[model samples]
Target chain A: MWKTVVRRLIIMIPQIILLSMLVFTVAHFMPGDPFTGIIDPNVDAARLEELRRAAGYYDPLHVQYFRWVGNALQGDFGRSFAQKVPVTTLIGARAMNSIRLGIVSTVFTYAIALPFGMLSGRYNNSWFDRFVMIYNYVSYAIPTFVLALLFIYIFGYQLQWFPTRGSASPVIPKGTAPYYWDMFYRLLLPGFTAGILGTATTTQTLRNEVIDAKTQDYVRTARSKGVPENVIYNKHIFRNAFLPIASSIGFIFSGLLNGSVFIERIFAFNGMGDLFITSITSRDYSVVITLVLFYGVISIIGSLVSDIVLSLVDPRIRIE
Target chain B: MATDNTLIEVNNLNVGFRFGDEYYNAVEDVSISLAKNEILAIVGESGCGKSTLATAIIGLHDPHNTRIEGEILYNGLDLTKLNEKLYNRLRGNDISMIFQDPLGSLNPVMTIYKQIEESLIYHTKLNDKERYDRVLELLNQVGIPKPERVMKQYPHELSGGMRQRVVIAIALANKPPVIIADEPTTALDVTIQAQILDLMKDIQEETESGIILITHDLGVVAETADRVAVMYAGQIVEEAPVDVLFTDPKHPYTRSLLNSIPNELHEDGEELHVIQGTVPSLQNLPRKGDRFRDRIPWIPDEAFDEDPILHEIAPGHKVRGNSWKYFHFEGEEME
Candidate 1:
């Protein structure tokens, strides 16, 4: 399994490089020029041309792509023309904020979903099961942006429960202990909005699978042989049913990053989603290309981790 | 003279299930006594209620739609009235069962040792070390060489015959007085089936436990059964010693079934007879006295107009018959 993971990583490097080149090439050719936005438009044409040349705009697309790729290989994602900071540093801090949201939501989703899913499976077709099914459908039908806005209105504006705009309090002093706590508190509303919808879908689907697993003939044999119901459910049914769900964890994590784009925009939270929006709007081509490539790498690695976990859950799977 | 060694006395067992609006009785008024150290085989065609009776004996019926009336006396205790906890204690310890498909009968994910150790852990108060030793010993007793290797192996790693042996090890773990094998060898190849049957017989002899072998093959009954009960349409139409059932079958259903088994070694193509019609469905049973004849429209009307009740025909043989009919051999009828 470890060998398979390493091989997959080795294979993904070229795909990442190709992806980086394509996104960089496209962002370079986009209609807007960042030089006019950042450099003074009032400056003479000669000075503006000099600034553009220094920024590598005078070079061919192929040469510029190779230069960026070479810098990226050495952990330098170039300087952002809009922010006047290293692209790598800007993305690094934003990536941490995104990680906070991803980790919090994923943990909350599973903790709430697993037991409720088991209960729904145990009492299949009961009122509880139907209620969960209805809940899943209702939550899934509403868009994430709409939900985030609703939560912000209910909890932030009207209810005065949580602050709506920023990740942390302005008065707590930046980068202090209280600042981090304030950031976590503000992220909670959007985090829970995402978790509730994701967990509701997983609970309904996994409950159905677990119910089917419990009805297998082996379960009947176990019950007839006098094995306790709880043992049967834990050691046999859940273990078997968890295989597909475990594999799906990779998909959920990858999707969590993608889905956060809208959630961050709605709540003005400073994360990868906000970074992506700012880079697109300002035409910061280097940072936009780097962030896209970074997301691609995360997806590939997440899939590899999921496969390894699934192999551990079911002995029949061999990664190699 | 008969000795009083009966372990389980099943009296007038009537089991039925509700299908939407109507109730269908699968087994009606079937009584049989199983003695210690005896192998009684219940043989019948598919859907004959043999397996239903076995499940009722073990209290494994679904409580949603099933209703069981009649006493299953195991050492003078009625099993039907016992609560779930008490019945659970008695199941693997006092009575165990083996199923038809050996593959589906054992949990695929569990190790052979864990599966065998379950009954011992539940019924016996032995420490972990003693339980391990007993599991190894039971595995070896059931003809699994290298019990240590088998202990760590899962069900899918073992062959069909080996898996069935592990199942037998589990059945014999608590040394239950009765082991009900519901067509234990039906899922195996012919050669493996013979070996499993012989192994079961040897196990019965060594443990001195009564076995209820539920099957449809008369050949298995001939080889292993001490007493035989032939069922048809949810009733025991013939009950006799193994030899008597094969030789002087007094019920028309039993006689037709016995004739159905092709005797290639003895009778060289003499038009082997088969049972004429299908068994009646439990959902639509005809009225009394008209059931047997009306269900089999293919059979001649005169042969089955009267519904035959299973009655004693000789000292130890019983059949569903009156005094007029006798078993015929080589075109000669013996009264």
Candidate 2:
């Protein structure tokens, strides 16, 4: 198992390099430069050149990329043009905010989806089953951003339950202790919306998987051996049914990160997605490229994690 | 649990399933009984509802979607009337089934010992150590060499015959009064099939438990079955003691099935006869009038249109419709 994890991690190296390079090149050609934002019309050309030289912008594209990659490997993410701070420091703060919400949403999504899905599938065509199907399709059909706005209106405007937007109100004193609670309060709306949709789709996929697993000969054997219905559902059916869901994690993990983009912006959570929006509009090339590479890294890592998990779930998978 | 009395008596059972818009009967008015320590083999071609009958007798199929009418009396208790709770208690404790596809029937993820231990855990109050000891003994009884090694191995690690042996070990774990082996050796190779049959015979003799062997193979019936029940087209066409049925098959369908088996000990190139005309679809079964129609249309109407019924033509032998006159019952004149 350790060998398989090590091998997967090793394979991820070239993938990360290739992906980062591709993202860097694409962000490089995306219209304006980071120096464009820093340079003023009144500033002298010599002074602008000095700033550009310090930023490594005057170097050849390949040389600049190699330098940036070298610095990135050493945990130096260059500097943000707009923020005028180390890109790593800015990302680190906002990345935690995003991770807080994303992790909570993912855990909640799976917890709700699995049992509900299995039960729905096991009792197909019944009233309860049909209700789940209707709810899932309707939930999935509505855009998540629209749902976010609606939730804000319902809970924030009408119900007066949650705060309107942002990870936390500025009035709240910033400290390590209550800071997470503040983040959770602000994330509740967006996280709830994202989780609902995630639950909807994952439940649909899991439902079909459970239905297939229920028909398996082993399930029939368990039932024939006079195992209780609950035992059959939990041990024999659910464990075997998790294979398709395990394989699906790679896609869902990537989608979760990407889908968080719009939702993150609406909620005013200053995370990677907000960084992406700001970098593109302000033409902060360094920040934009760094964020793109970050996403690429996440995609690759998620896939590796999923593969390792699949091997663990199904013993038939040979690492070699 | 062997006694002078019968263990299970199935009376005029009919099993049917809803096909598309209509309910079609699969096993029609079938009656059979399993005496203590008697090996009763239900033999028929595929789609003959023989397996369905076996399942009905065992109360495995649900009555909600499946319509099963008739009494299945086990120890004077109507199995059909027993609730799911009672049935669950009785299933592994009083009776258990070994399925056809051994690998498919055994859980892929579980260890062989765990699968065997499952029955003991569910049905008996045996402690963990006792269950483990019994599992090893059961594994050994099924002719699995090195029971300790097999106990730790998963289903995929073993060969087809080994998996079947594991299933048998599981079925016998609770020491049920009756063991239903549905085509137990059908999925195995010829040599492996023989070994499994031998193992089952030995187990039955030692345990003294009645085994309801469900299979289409006549050779298996000839080797192990004490009595044979021949089913055709959703009904038992004929039934008799094993030797008597082999020597004097009363029904035309049973006679044709018995004749299809090639005797290796017979003369060389002696072509074996095969039953022609496919078994009709369960949806629209043939009427009683067209029961044994000719394979070739050129033959006279007398070649078919005879509704054969089970009749005793000899002592301890029942044929379908008037076999007492002669073995040429297939050509019997209709009134």
Best by TM-score: 2
DockQ winner: 2
What digit string (tens of lDDT, one per residue) describes model 2 on residues A155-267? 98999988877877677688766876876778777777777878887898889888888878787678677888888888887877887788767656666766788888887
RMSD of 2: 3.2
Residue pairs with colliding backbones in model 1 are none
Stretches of candidate 2 above 4 Å error? A30-35, A39-63, A176-179, A318-320, B1-3, B264-266, B287-290, B293-308, B323-335
Candidate 1 has a DockQ of 0.48
Fnat of each candidate: 0.31, 0.42
Task: Report lDDT (Cα) of residue A18, candidate 2.
Answer: 91
How do the residues B1-335 of candidate 1 rate in per-residue lDDT, one tens digit apiece? 12478888998898998999766889887889899999999999898899999989988887778989988899889998998788888888889998888778777667888888888877889999999999989988999989999898778788999999988888888899999999999999999999999999999999999999999988899999999998877788889999988877777667767777887544775777645567778887653663445433444445553666667879778876452263343344454
Q: Which lDDT tens digits does candidate 2 get at residues B177-283?
A: 99899999999999999999999999999988989999999999999999998887788778899998988775667766776787765578886775678888887
